[model samples]
Target: MDINDLRSAVTLVSLLLFAGIAAWAWRPRNQAAFEDAARLPFSDEQGGQS
Candidate 1:
């Protein structure tokens, strides 16, 4: 394939990968996990524990 064809293939693959990740992140079952992650920065842990 030519350079143009290779570029198109890469773009299509990147788009598909992004869509798959978006779908996974938006699924209802993952809502709780995502929320917990969103709260991590505000948690009150003082320091890293052993």
Candidate 2:
């Protein structure tokens, strides 16, 4: 296996991984979970007593 072949394989694997993740993340069934994750930083877990 030449260096170029390894490079091409790595690129193809990376692209496939990116596409799979994008699909998983954007699918309708995952919308709620993603939305909840998106709100984690603003959740105010300390309560409203401030």
Candidate 3:
């Protein structure tokens, strides 16, 4: 019921919401796009020479 308690509750809620969204976003069909995007930076960093 204090400011500290309110802050902790907000942080916990935010983390849970983020986890839910992340799980939904990474569902099988969406996962391939996410994986491709995730690898893009690494590929670019390696000069994309492969």
Top model number, TM-score: 1
Query: Which runs of model 3 end up more than 4 angstroms from their true locations?
Result: 29-50
Q: On a 0 to 100 scale, what is the lDDT of residue 17 in model 2?
A: 100
Which residue pairs clash within candidate 3?
none
Question: Model 1: which residue pairs collide?
Answer: none
Tens-place lDDT per residue, model 3, 1-50, is 99999999999999999999989997898978888998876775656556
Task: Give candidate 3's error at residue 38 in angstroms.
Answer: 14
Model 1 alpha-carbon miss at residue 5, Å = 0.6
Model 1 quality (TM-score): 0.84
The TM-score of predicted model 2 comes to: 0.80
lDDT of each: 0.95, 0.94, 0.88
The residue ranges of model 2 lying beyond 4 angstroms of the native Cα positions read 45-50
**Number of colliding residue pairs in each model:** 0, 0, 0
| Predicted structure 2: lDDT | 0.94
Rate residue 1 of model 3 by lDDT.
92
lDDT of 2 by residue, 7-43 (tens): 9999999999999999998899999998999999889
